[model samples]
Target: MGTPLLVAEDISISFGGIRALKGVDLTVEEGQIVCLAGENGCGKSTLVKIVSGVYTPSTGTISIGGDSFNALKPRQAIAEGVQVIYQDLSLFDHLSVAENIAINRLIHDGSVLSNRAEVQRIAAEQLERIGIDLDLDAPVSELSVANKQIVAICRALSMDARILFMDEPTTALTTNEVKRLLAIVLDLKKRGMAVVFISHKLDEVFEIADKITIFRDGSKVGDFTASELDEVSLSFHMTGREIVYNRYHRTRTEDQPLLEVRELSRADNYEDISFTVRPGDILGLTGLLGAGRTEIALSLFGLNRPDSGTILIDGKTAAITNPWDALDYGIALLPEDRKTQGLFGQQSVKTNITSTMLDRLLTPMRMISGRKEDALATELVHSMNVNNKDISVLVDNLSGGNQQKVVLGKWIGTEPRILILDSPTVGIDIGSKSEIYAKIHDLAADGIGIIFISDEPEEIVANCNRVLVMHEGSMITSLEEEDLRADGIKERLAEIISDPDSFAGTNSGARVQGEQA
Candidate 1:
């Protein structure tokens, strides 16, 4: 409808034998939000990478402002004013806000020494212009997730990028932060910036996107106006088939609990919380951002300590003081933040696959033998169906699905009894999700108890046999086979959070901040 801001026609890219993107066509119009949606390994990231110049499409022609462009090199793409903010916030926590924001400009200016003062001024001005009240000199780690996110956006602005690609931009953002970010996006659009938002949250895609692009298996399926798409219809396109969007398929057994987390109190995260993840269970934990779903996983993984609590892994009390201990206790955590605790981007598949099991495989010298590591990695790669050229390839080079498979592989190699998948399917493709689902079934069939956490209520209902709903920092209620519906769970959680007196039954001291109304 409007003049295109950026366009790519017949884009193609290959990795070894795999055609990651095949003649895909996409565009972003000026002052518009066009979102691309699909399952992991569906070429969404590939397209974004090509547009942002992180990858040069093996073949394709691109134009920005109706002029030809190629992102053969990263600097070339940056100079061309195409910016990308990946799933991981690219801010350096040790750096000041100014340093992070003005990095591109300062480095581009070719200053022999860093221009700290000028960078600070420019960063502060950018924040001020965006109406965000952040201190320029503050260390990034000191800022909240929302503020740190703003800093990432400011850094993008410094590139003067006409088109910005945001991958899962609001994955961890609270509803309010999401609103603020959307407002900022709209403000940038009014100023004639083109934004390409990629996310799994369909509610967000429907709300902010003016146009939507659908990608399936390395090709663009079709494009549609936002008004022309709804969640069910769009899910069909993204998944390439009919998928019943049901969130309550829990089937709890009337037996003793498989896992009884009694008084699980992690200081400042959750307190005095008791819950059970039963066998053949998909314990659905839903809450707004910072509702402590992730913190709970971390404590279970032994990454963090609960001030006081009892974890009965299998009717037996267990002391899990660290990740190794958790693994030994048959508890494996697929961390919420994939980059932080999930993947080793720079490491080879072999290295990362056995990283979690080094203590188990290594001799007293603690050096993991290459043969043992290779054997474990090879087994996991095959078991998880990791599609890649070789086992030694860097995990980052693979598609999202394959990368996720590697993440799965790492955990499976450890072979814990309780497998904790925190948003394991986030930002991945349908086929990959199905594969992951099969893997989940396989793990369950093998009698591994699972605690699966996701924002998508539908995913929890369909894949899990039992759902546990959380609000603030407490597990409000558990959903059995009969009570696994999203609407039912949602209403229950809402009622619990809405009525303060109802919480008298629950004395959870840990608070959940920033939940959407």
Candidate 2:
């Protein structure tokens, strides 16, 4: 560690008589990586906002490179080389990648003319500096979530930020992309830059952090060296409880399959995808990003129109050309990106949870009944185990885990026979993940066929009874019952996902016979 580049002391803030942060102290030294870890709404974000001048602290002193201030303005913080890459990335969607990256510098430099070449040069230089390549001419809106995160990082580097704060950077990233991003962060640290990485992922924190800080209920719990803590201790500090996740095993039922897709093919998206999801089975779809796992799920949910296929729900041909048709055939889809596709953030929890079945809450005269809405919302909240006492609270005010539960409740209101959960546990904390896993098991035990989709091998191995591997828009292989029960299953599944060709000739225990051409 080098000299301290940024320090905040006695930080506390309040909004509407609610203390968002309480007496938190943080220090980021030059050439050091510090991880700020806590459950959602634990004041980690509040402190970062304060240091970056997005929020003023109720009482605190901030020192940037030994220059002290009671509270810094946004421009003042920028002048002191502080840059924050918020989760939203804050990029101009309509602008090209090059323009989005260089626009900040051009504006800061007070350039009068639109120098397109200069913008391209600056963007290219920053991308090369980070050792990541991206299309300069591609519009920001056209990039994937991972690429957008890289753009955000490159933009931060363009500002020559001495210290960078990344909020939940890896939440949307795949495993490989996360590794690359961590490498970039380490590279930045080696170049004498400070990084404050806020994440719920303990593995990444242990892999990259020099120091780890824990926060709980708007107060600092403790700060410890990476060597001083493990995941168990970290979880204990963050949630005040020991986190435990039990491996799930499917309960055997009769031979009737609840949902089946024969040769489901979508041009340029997925091809020859065939699978059978039995009632009360949590069948997982696992592969790298863009491996057609989500594409197949989308088709099943009627979000994507498959060019050729037959969908059998309860052994009957279901022509699901649209989402309404899917719903009519007793199918419910919990979409991948919950924020954009699932819940109404600005609405009350009652409104979001009961949004799917509002017609069920009508009065005798066919008018919407507030009393019925409240009763159903209360029932769903209790059944879903959502962490909200009041149903009227805005969904945005709840934690990420709670918000996800609200989405699940909304979909569960439909009471479908088949539930498609696409990355259901993404960005959720460990405790909540366990809870959600239990809920999934419960749903399956209730005879609801679940099509669980995720890129994480451990989750797939733990929660799934049978697993199918996809590669390049095709169903590559399926892990049989014995394969799912073997030791090192997660590692073996990961290997197959990383490279499916390696197991083609070998008796790898996985059912290569199930591989699709």
Instruction: State the lDDT of candidate 2 residue by residue for 460-508, as single tens digits.
Output: 8888888888777877678765677777777777777766666443331
Q: Report per-prediction Cα RMSD to one decimal.
A: 4.9, 2.9
| Cα lDDT tens digits for candidate 1, 85-160 | 8877888989988888998778887877776788888898788877888888899989887788899899988778
lDDT of each: 0.76, 0.87
Indicate which candidate wins on TM-score: 2
Candidate 2 yields a Cα-based lDDT of 0.87
TM-score per prediction, in order, is 0.81, 0.95
Candidate 2 is scored at a TM of 0.95
* Model 1 / residue 361 / CA error / Å: 8.1
lDDT measured at residue 158 in model 1 versus the true structure, 0 to 100: 79
